[model samples]
Target: MAGRGDHTTVPGQFPAQGLRAVLGGWSGAGTKPRNDDAISGRIPETAYEMQVKGAIACIADGISTGLNSDKAAQISVVQFARDYYSAPESWPVRDCAGRLLNSLNSWLHAQNRSGSPDAEGMVTTFTAAIARSTTLHIVHIGDTRCQRLRAGRLVPLTEDHSARFMGGSESLTRALGAEADIRVDYAQETMAEGDLYILTTDGVHDTLGEAGMRDRLAGLPQESREDLEAASRALCQAALEAGSSDNVSCMLLKILALPSETLPEAHRRLTAQVIPPAMKPGNRIDGWEVLEVMHSSTRSNVYLVRRAGEDGRFVLKAPSQNFAENLQYLEGFTLEQWVGRRITNSQVMKIRPHEDSRFLYYIADFVEGETLRDWMKAHPKPSIAEIIPVLASLISAVRVFHRLGMVHRDLKPENVIIAEDGTAKIIDFGSVQVSGFRDLERGDKEELPEGSLNYIAPEVLTGQGAQPLSDLFSVAAITWEMLAGRVPFDLEERTALPSRPADWAAGDFAALRPDLPPATGEVLSRALAFSPKDRPEVMSEFLGEMRKLQGRAGTRPVFVPLLQRGSRGFWRGWALAATAVAAALAVALVALLP
Candidate 1:
């Protein structure tokens, strides 16, 4: 075997610190007149597609007994590379592979002829893999094998679809073109950096048992790593030297990196972005012209901007030029855009798609509307009938974020904008907390909660992390403020709301609104429970109780159930009744004894 040290091949680079990789493949006819094994691999160009679909590698081995087996092998390998890339980027890897292979199988099955062993058809063994995120997805048919060489051993990642034949020979019982509707065996395995994936034809694998293969892989040259082409050539050469008379083929892929954004890398990318140049009205930056300063704050400045040649009106939020070094604020600004791009709900604010701008800012649809806080001022002392739908919409919008593993920590009425058409759009995601994104913070100490203190949950003030329950607590607070003109608790600075339901007695909501129902107070009390465990764990549970208000009774009931009135009263009643029964039973027992 020639050493790869003598040759140099350029490696592939991808996003996320250039997810680098090396690939090598080799094929040849051992003793056969013509080779019938084919292989191909691909890496997408864009970061989004690469992260979503990942890279693909495929191998196919044609049946020796079938005519045009060489064509079968070549076509399967070639078409898969083309079709897999052409599939929808939004589809999951499994769905894309299945849909593409199903069409390929249909085409091959259409070419079938005789049902004999030595039949003329385009039947072939097929196996392929996709490496994405931190996983490898493998889909196989027939006998071409996919295996991983890790921890000094070769582990098979596929199973052959062959049955016992006469004299210990094996015949393929399942293949790509064997049936009209094919079943593609699929599985996924977690992957690590430096992991090696090897695809082989039966000729290469059958000649070398698992132990011999492990030895061969271990013997691979390590001095000049990333020599996949040389390793593959060497692997195929070994199988030929081992007395194999069939076509030999091998493909190798060495994982160097997985696509992911680390905290340091994210900081670098963000800091590299251009800070918005200070400009008054009529200044143009990257095809957008500033019209007027919409608003200015210590953190950022919002401007009403216009596209150079388009009629679209947009709101551009630029970080204040002075705060460029504030990584905490920059992180929030970046995350606001990230969340905006991913979530598409009627009640959630939508960011307008824009060309890559050099400034540290993003564009959003200019909603000419008033904040919900302003609306509350106009509709002071709003009735419960008028408040349920709006509150429901708010909770429903928050649920979308939760479904995507996000928490809207700052969900106060001030962040919610109410359009003239009565549509409520939740805006300002800079304070939104993401469970996954937090993992990338690299031990960066969490700053104080940036949420509005008046509507924040009690736990947030006590230095606890915000959760879904805490998020709902804010919504319930807004609900109370909307109906009774104030939240269940006082909103003074440095005053944290009680943490448990038992401690919520200080907030007698009905005292302010004499007409308020006890049921409404109970739900509000449960939602704003001091301990998150006592609060409704899911938004649906809180919404379910609110839904009961829309039943035959237009409002919540004031009647307290016997069981729920108070623990003390129920236990006391039971004790009194038990004493009377005991006295009567004692007199009866005395009469019986006499």
Candidate 2:
């Protein structure tokens, strides 16, 4: 097998400045050994860049023990990086993963169908580590592991997909080429001097638990001539002693310390990295002027923009450095773009991006209206006549997503913008969950979905799987607040809001305003159901129920529950004095009285 000695470092890790990393791994020359480990690299080409750069290394363990497992693992790691770097800069993480998986699946399946037993049931497990500057992004699957050693203790930084504690039926839960697409577990950790990272095949991990591994690493002194190499040897010896039977491979990494003067320079260097020049003003990016910045967010920046070729205008969204650096955020942003494009209506904002590339900025039709929160505050207690129409519009707006088989996981008043025409436009598909977007077989839930904590559905707050019903629950909460003049959960005396499964059931929107129309009240009760299945199955059902209650009264606005005009009471003595004064005035004005 080729080693790190031959492969280059990743583009982002070059120029060898602060936090230099050295990765060296060896395969034991034991009997029945199969060199199932695959590694890749990229080093700086320019002398100046290399002077201030670091290095990146990745190790993949092909399940050589299984039929053609070695080949399967080898192809996955190699193709992943190749496909990743070759793709356009705008490729979203999910799209990238999906594309890579498709390429791999096609290759693996074709190889399997070629009538060779080795290709028939072929599968492999792998773990990969990407180190750059001062951070490590670890992506892995199966029992192959990545461990972090800080202050002489080895920490398992990567979760074992097959670990029984994490619901791996009996062993490792996931493996490469196990199915059509692979699910990679990703995590990011800061790299510091004196930190040691270890990536290994199951052979090494099976031999030592955390305590046992710590003992072996503890004996080695840092900076010793043989420290790094010896540590790998000790692990192998321990595994052998523990009765390991498979080939043991290990990639040991040591983060070399940096000089004090270099730390500040590195900070300046990283921060000074400039964005590429923007397109010329007249140059259109998806028909929107790349206007000056409006706002910046962790994932992306919002720009106040106008349509280039048309009379329309919108807010153009560009991925932030934070989103661009990480694959996950890029994927989520891509999904938002996808959902927005697929479902275009007056109720939903029109989302347009540069043709085919995920890297391009997107234009969303801007809504010129106040958020529901702002509207409600200006008119403290609005009657049903004033509120029901807004609710109807919101429900009508959200109904489009349901028809598209999508759920707006985050539906709050803040996300609902009431347009000047009274059209309550529902925006922010950023948190939407479409049925096609999920992979149920692996049970991987969407991470940190965008939503307001105050308005999230009870089921969602507890980390339950997001579904259509949860969206309904949130919609109900918003509607309830519309009619009741207050949030259902606000009056409760709790240190913090309940974050448990039971708390969702405890909320009663009806209790906040019992005087609400029976139909409106019933809809709220059903929508805020504890179990997601019990809520309205779709937006149409909720809209139908709302329309029924709205029709019982006239189309005109009414402030029935919100306010009323009262007559002023007259004082008895004041009335008598006023009468006497009126009688005297009446004598003088007799002609006027006649």
Candidate 3:
């Protein structure tokens, strides 16, 4: 008494034209009285979502021994596909899927614990495949499986979690509600245009086997969605006809195309606007009038602007025409706007949306403040007490970027703005590195480091990519300059940039400021280590050490003798003493003569 339960086909429609695939799913009960299997999937309607979160296909199989196994299977598959698309687009696909699966497992376990006694609780096996960009990300638990067929070769992508007992009996070693805590397997595979992926439950895979499934899939057309649907139904039917006594399910996804692996492709897909030419005062574009040319450089231009019929002012930034054809620079410019719009911290500048604009530029909130460079110039050789508050604010700002999976690769005095109330806001997103963007990139080409030479981390200079530790290094360099009136490394004095990590050495902070506690120098030294591994494991650790130094500054003595302080202090002290001795000798000679 075999019967089909549910069947669906998610149409292959990519309006913006990227990552196209065709999906079909079918489920049925072979001989069991009730079918406790579920299948679900989603293809986003928007191209932005496709590029960021991608499409998902999931299947779950409930244990027949459980009373509410059907409910468990349905809930797991449906909830996972729905919730995964709702996650932040900035998160890496692996992180988003891992977190959702963990949460889903916990909720299923809780339902089992709260169920009525005298009946087995809900339990099921789960497996999912996410097609993002040019790769397939797989997450799995229990015996539910995902496999790929490429170039006529069928490859298993997931391992079953069931174990055979001594007497030939089998039991699941892992499932969604089998335990309070779950450990799921994760893997990735590079996808090709003609690749076909299959997802199945043990009912289908164990009964038909890979050989039988391949036999059923042989001669299936690649482009016809109807043919893929027929193949999915055939696989389940073949499994049941082969003497399967349980629920059978099968899902098919065929990759028809992948996104282009180039910066120009990304630019075209992201925006259709043209880069605005160099702007000056009185220039108007997209209803915003440029009141002043704030700053202009070969890379970009910043202007103070005001929109028509608005009293508030804004800062508009545009990429320079010099790099109009530079795809990498244009991509970074677009990413800067994307990052700004997503972040909502007071310490980070906010991007105002202008969806109707025809030019490539972003408008940001204008904060009235002086650059940290100007502040440093005004308070040359600022005391440790004076620097602690500013440093704390700067660190707070940086933590926001880190929490959002970003690294501000360039952190220097000029990039920070200090308000009259001592609030520090980090600016300049040109060099920020985003984990999400890295996941989307296809190539692994190395490029020169992206920050001012003195402030960039030593590891980055040597071709190591920027990380949170790299940002910490830049912050420490800025802090060192504020306290000692000089950078930690004299990068300007070098004939050329350091080609190796060993060539870059941090200058001696203790030698310049002996009045501060020795621990202060130790903290800065650790932050500016030549290797990222040698630095504090996280930004919080570096901040903790800085706070400790700040706490000790009150009790610590700063009245060291001038000779031990520094060269300038020692020479000034000597000059004052010599002048006093000369005055004393003149008085003595005058009295003796009189």
**Predicted model with the maximum lDDT:** 3
- Local accuracy of candidate 1 as per-residue lDDT tens digits, 1-594: 111111223223344444444566777777888777887776667765665567777888888877877777778888987887775443456766788889888877877754544435688999998887677889999999999988787899999999997768888988888789888999999888878888888989999877766787786763233467677777778888999888888777677786566667766877998888666789888878899987887777888899867777888888887778777778888778878887787778788667776667788878779988898999897667777777777887788787766778888887888877777788788877776444234356465566667677777666687788888888888888887887666656535555554655537776776565557778888888877898888887888887675442325456877777668978899989999999999999999994
**Candidates 1 and 3 compared by TM-score, better number:** 3
Q: By TM-score, how accurate is candidate 3?
A: 0.88
Using TM-score, rank the candidates from best to worst. 3, 1, 2
User: Candidate 3 lDDT, tens digit per residue, 1-594?
Assistant: 111365556545454577887777788876888888888877777888888888788899999888888888888888888888777676677777788988988887887787565225689999999998998999999999999998778999999998988878788999998898889999998899889999998888899889888888989775655776688888888888899888888888888889876665655744577879898899899888999999999988999999877779999999888877666677777778888898998999898777677788899999889999999999987777788889889999998988877888888998899988999998787778877667686573334444578898876776667888999999999998998899878786788877765666666677787767778888998898888889999877887787777655433455777567668867888899999999999999999994
Model 1 lDDT on a 0 to 1 scale:
0.75
Ten-residue stretch with the least lDDT total in model 1: 1-10
Off by over 4 Å in 2: 1-34, 40-58, 65-67, 79-118, 129-143, 153-193, 202-249, 252-311, 314-364, 367-474, 481-520, 526-594
Local accuracy by lDDT, each model: 0.75, 0.63, 0.82
TM-scores for all candidates: the values are 0.62, 0.45, 0.88
Predict model 3's lDDT versus the native: 0.82
**Alpha-carbon shift of residue 373 in model 2 (angstroms):** 9.7
Q: Candidate 1: which stretches are off by over 4 Å? A: 1-16, 24-41, 47-193, 199-209, 218-251, 257-268, 277-292, 341-347, 353-358, 395-409, 431-449, 453-474, 488-514, 524-544, 551-594
Question: In terms of TM-score, how similar is model 1 to the real structure?
Answer: 0.62
Ranking of models by lDDT: 3, 1, 2
Q: Is candidate 2 or candidate 3 better by TM-score?
A: 3
Cα displacement (angstroms), candidate 2, residue 58, comes to 4.9
lDDT of 2 by residue, 1-594 (tens): 224221222222223544455555555633344656565443344533222222444566665556776677667767775655454323333454456656776677667667888686456666666554455657677788889888877789887676556554346557766666667777777678888778777777876777777787785754532455566666766777888776666667677753233334433433343322344344455445665665565656777677646676677776666543444445566578777776768888878645544344566777788888788787665666677678778878887786655678888887788899889887677877665334311123245565566567766666666666777777777777777777656523556767654565535444554444545666777777777777777766876777677545433344754223443343556668899999999888986774
- Winner of 2 and 3 under lDDT: 3
